[model samples]
Target: YRTKIVARSQNNKMHTIISWSIPLGNNILLSYIFAYGLGNHINITSILLPTIGILFIALGNYMPKTQRNRLVGIRIPTALNNDINWFKTQRIGGLMFVVGGFMMIGGGFLGMISEFWTIALMILPLVLITVVPIIYSIRSSHKA
Candidate 1:
């Protein structure tokens, strides 16, 4: 399988792999190793790392650019019918996703709020982002 390392940021100091193979076993093994390394020092952040890693792996495989319209990707009907609308909606949605992710991640770090509340905050923005584009696409389509 093909593989490549991508650096997200200089400060982050972590590299993500773009891989064609399913590395579920490898991931589990790595998680175990990390957990063991942090034995007796386990904390919320340690737990969050694996959760975020899983999310990143899943998202990498199911990104909008890769799965345009099956079921998981954006599915605004009007946007699907019009390339320009599709591009615009996806770009906007992508930005919303990044922002929501950051908020959720920050909330995790803060550890003051309940996990459910943090998740809700992330979800609400995503839902709004999705709705806005769909509404705009429909309105624009009607005008055309």
Candidate 2:
């Protein structure tokens, strides 16, 4: 039964230790806990906003790579019916995703804005990002 403890250093590095000691209850292995600086405040919005931004960017890049299948990527009913519709929609959607992703990344920095403006900023981009692609996909299906 052993325990390991890792500590943060002055230069913001980690020190790893291998400890072998007495066994725990019922010969259980020792648990491990990694801790950052004490009293470190993490900003939730900062982490989430960039994560979502990166997701959109990744999705944008992925859209072009995916084949038209019911299981993955953007799966709209109308778009699903036609390959040409799917391809065009994906291309436009990919572009929108890239734009939307950048907008979300930019929104992550709006910590100083008023709540009203913040909501407006985020909502508008979201609607543009998602709704427009759906509309475009549906319309293209009609044309095909």
Candidate 3:
């Protein structure tokens, strides 16, 4: 992929620059940085960094809202087994992500959690929430 910029002045002067490389999608890099608690101190940056990263990750993973048996979306085997279940699972997962992200962001301001625990606090609920739908979908599928 390549990006280019061109600018022209009233004096008829022009400047052009072109860059070529795979775009480092912000989510990919931010997730790594947030995973490491890069800006995680008892400060604004601490809360903002991870919150932004999580939001990007959530948005990027669940865009276009199509039902699919893919790895990134709601991939409950049962959900993938049917289109309606897939849609419902994805919607629920997306809502869970939003709630989880907000919770983590709110938790960041509390200052009671140590940096280490903050990372865990932010991640664990999301994992649990993500898992619930899969488990439910499986059970529901099996029952059917």
Candidate 4:
């Protein structure tokens, strides 16, 4: 399914880049998971949380390079309107992703406590990472 999305991509370069991102991201995520031999005695939540985190880090790293485009990055209209907003949003997003990745690694440790807390640690950081940038872009645009 993901391959089809990448193969059928339209003229938008960012769209194409972001489209290919998923499969490439997944490869990285899987590589990290297996690199640890977690598969030998896998705790499902422990493995899953870190996998998502690694991918978030990769995507966030890529965000700043996306430029303003309908098909990628934070596509909110106000953000797309200015390069400052776009880059600022991406920078913050990248930082959040890196932080979120660490949080997920910590969450993997928490998996021994309970799956709920493990999932929460991973997901909350990601949610905050995504939402804060959007809000920042919108508010900054209003100020301008």
List the global CA lDDT of all models.
0.51, 0.61, 0.54, 0.73
Instruction: State the lDDT of candidate 1 residue by residue for 1-144, as single tens digits.
Output: 111212123212112233422475466557767877878444444345335434543443333342234233356687768766665666556555555555555645544446565566556645755676677667777877
Model 4 segments more than 4 A misplaced: 1-41
TM-score of 4: 0.69
Tens-place lDDT digits, model 3, residues 18-63: 0111133344456657766865434544555455546634553453
Give candidate 3's whole-model lDDT: 0.54
Better of 1 and 3 by TM-score: 3
Candidates 3 and 4 compared: the better one by TM-score is: 4
Number of colliding residue pairs in model 2: 0
Q: Rank the candidates by lDDT, best first.
A: 4, 2, 3, 1
The regions of model 3 sitting more than 4 angstroms off are 1-45, 48-64, 69-71, 111-120
Q: Return the lDDT, model 2, position 57.
A: 75
Runs with alpha carbons beyond 4 Å of true place in candidate 1: 1-73, 112-117
Model 2 over residues 1-144: C-alpha lDDT tens digits?
111121122111111111111232113211211112444455445445555666677667767655666544567998778888888888888888888877777776773455554455567668877898899998888776
lDDT of 4 by residue, 50-110 (tens): 7677766777776776665565677777787898888888777778877887788779888
Error in Å for residue 51 of model 1:
6.3
What TM-score against the true fold does each predicted structure earn? 0.50, 0.66, 0.54, 0.69
CA shift at 19, candidate 4, in angstroms? 6.3
Error of 4 at 64 (Å): 1.9
Query: In model 1, how large is the Cα lDDT of residue 54?
Result: 46
Q: How large an RMSD does model 2 have?
A: 15.3
